[model samples]
Target: METFKIEGNVPLKGEITPQGAKNEALQILCAVLLTPEVVTINNIPDIIDVNKLISLLKNLGVKVTKIAKGSYTFQADAINMEYLESEAFKKEGSSLRGSIMIVGPLLARFGKGYIPKPGGDKIGRRRLDTHFEGLINLGAKFRYNKEDHFYGVESPRLKGATMLLDEASVTGTANIVMAAVLAEGKSAIYNAACEPYLQQLCKMLNRMGAKITGIGSNLLEIEGVTALNGCEHTILPDMIEIGSWIGLAAMTRSEITIKNVSWENLGVIPGTFRKLGITLEQKGDDIYIPAHTDGYEIQNYIDGSILTISDAPWPGFTPDLLSIVLVVATQARGSVLIHQKMFESRLFFVDKLIDMGAKIILCDPHRAVVIGHDFKSQLKATTMSSPDIRAGISLLIAALSAKGTSTIQNIEQIYRGYENIEERLKSLGAKIVSE
Candidate 1:
């Protein structure tokens, strides 16, 4: 039960590097199972969820070696098939949401994919129907055991087919793509998730001899290959963390430089923050955010209505950053509505903000209206427990901008995504201590 004691009212000023994308790492690591040869990966975030996934790979008899900090090589030549059905596996695989993605590569190579009920942030009903339904659409048999609470899919050989996904679910698309790459014949996936992570996955697979077209679009075309070879991949900088840095800079009136943020792939993140009247300067690959010394304000709609910052699929605003946006809005000069469309319960953490003297109204499970204090009213310190990863970091940003000392417990949730967060924040002049 570690806690973060963050002293508030100090402007954070320094340069910080965003870690490798956790969401991207999950898919790339799972893709390691697609080949028996060594798959080397760089820029791996040493986060709890990633380590748990790596441990799960080790349990499956994949040869994993740490070549360097944030780098690894995986060879899945000797998979232990028996472990997939073991009681220990069921519990371990169910511990993290990313574990479900393993089933896709496993099914592609070994003809069988089984996962126990996967666990993650209790944000809403994150259904596995998309993954299974996509697999089933590709001629795989699916089964769910109520007694053990397990999901399984198997096929002697996957036969490619054209399918339209119900939703452009990120992991679902990745799972299906992994399976489809090794499938026999041609496969076409329409309405697929075109996130940068997914695009990177497609590119890596292509490098490994999988013929995939439509790299950055929703319509993906894959020609089934008999086998895949090993390839090296470097993950993109985490856009979520980049957004967090932007929020922290504004909330604390800090002038900070986020280094090597992969500007081209940021897709509307910078513009979204700019809409909130935050100034950002791009230097080569880095983003320089100056202190909001004049205070920030929300932009209204063209019709003069209150502005709404909502989440959508990639190329649109990311749902992951809506929490950060909400926290940043608290100190702005105007009001904005946060609409979380994908996950329902993510906005529930606004209640905790209210307790800290924030003018936030929980409109529902999916929406919140934040009345920015314009730095006229400083947030009072309070003790709170973290509900999830994104919300925890958002609260940390809020705490740093607050007027007094704040204690945030259950920091383990924060560590699941952000690597060495307290250390990184401290280097950026944020007074956060882990105890």
Candidate 2:
């Protein structure tokens, strides 16, 4: 129930570092359960969702120790299998969508995994079939309690098999990969998600004695290992957060330098922002975004058709940044269409931006046409509530560039992803206060 009271029309300046990848942290943390040895993880973002998962791990008897800020050591030496059937677990496990991932490692090592219906951003229908079906294909028996809304998977031993996923779902692929790494034989996953986060998981698993090939492609070959040894791993900087900072710099006419951005792994994010005519420089692994005092312009397609920005699997534009893109487009010089293909309800937050004086046409649940105001008309600040993590940050960006004070409610959603966001913005001279 926290609120962000922001004074708008304030330009920000200074250097800010993006937090560790939240998505990767989720998958990586769950992988800790695959071994009983000590796993040291660096650059862990202290966000709500990640902390919740850590707490869940502690409840399940994993020994978690804080090494320092953004670092932790976890050893799942004595897990309480009985806790998985408890009411406390049902409530705790259902609160986080990431909790679904622990099932994979649990089922791999202990032969049984149970989870309550996981919950996350209500952006759209996020189905669990992908995670469960992948485990089932790996020789696990799946059962569901319709009345209690719980899922369980168990197997004496898992045998590897090739799987062609229905969709390249990231978390689904992570679940299956975790299970397959300890499975009886070699496994090939086609049409898998090859996002940088997933690649990190594969590489980390390899360091732990799991044989996984094709790190950066859709086809992953995993050879089951007898046992995995723990290793220290450092997470990459969050690309989505980096993209958000780029959009914030443009919309608020701020000059900002984002440090340690992992340039090579960004994959089309910089190019997508350039298509909006935003000027960003690469300065040795850092992204320097200059102030857009004169307003940026959107570039059309080569054939002169309107520029259409859409989300696809990795190596394409990320759906998570489409909200930021839509908000940034509001102050650009031309029009662009934003197609949010993965989630139907994510674009609904555009109505709040429309009220802030952005010229946006919500064509449908999946697409919106945004006509840039070119900074000729400054957005007027207004009261708004954050809908999800992405839309929440997008709204904060819009509010920062607005003409007056704006109040944003339900900012807890924002904290679920971004760590210490208000302080980070404040260090860049943004006038934001949380209450």
Worst 10 residues of 1 by lDDT: 423-432
RMSD of each: 0.7, 0.6
All candidates' TM-scores?
0.99, 0.99
- lDDT (10s digit) by residue, model 2, range 1-435: 889999999999999999999999999999999999999999999999999999999999999999899999999999999999999999999999999999999999999999999989999999988888889999999999999999999998999999899899999999999999999999999999999999999999999999999989999999998899999999999999999999999999999999999999999999999999999999999999988888899999899999999999998899999999999999999999999999999999999999999999999999999999999999999999999999999999999999999999999999999999999999999999999
Q: What's the lDDT for all of these models?
A: 0.93, 0.96
**For this target, which candidate reaches the highest lDDT against the unseen true structure?**
2
Each model's total of backbone clashes: 0, 0
Judge candidate 2 at residue 91 and give its lDDT: 98
**Residue range with the least summed lDDT across 10 consecutive positions in model 2:** 125-134
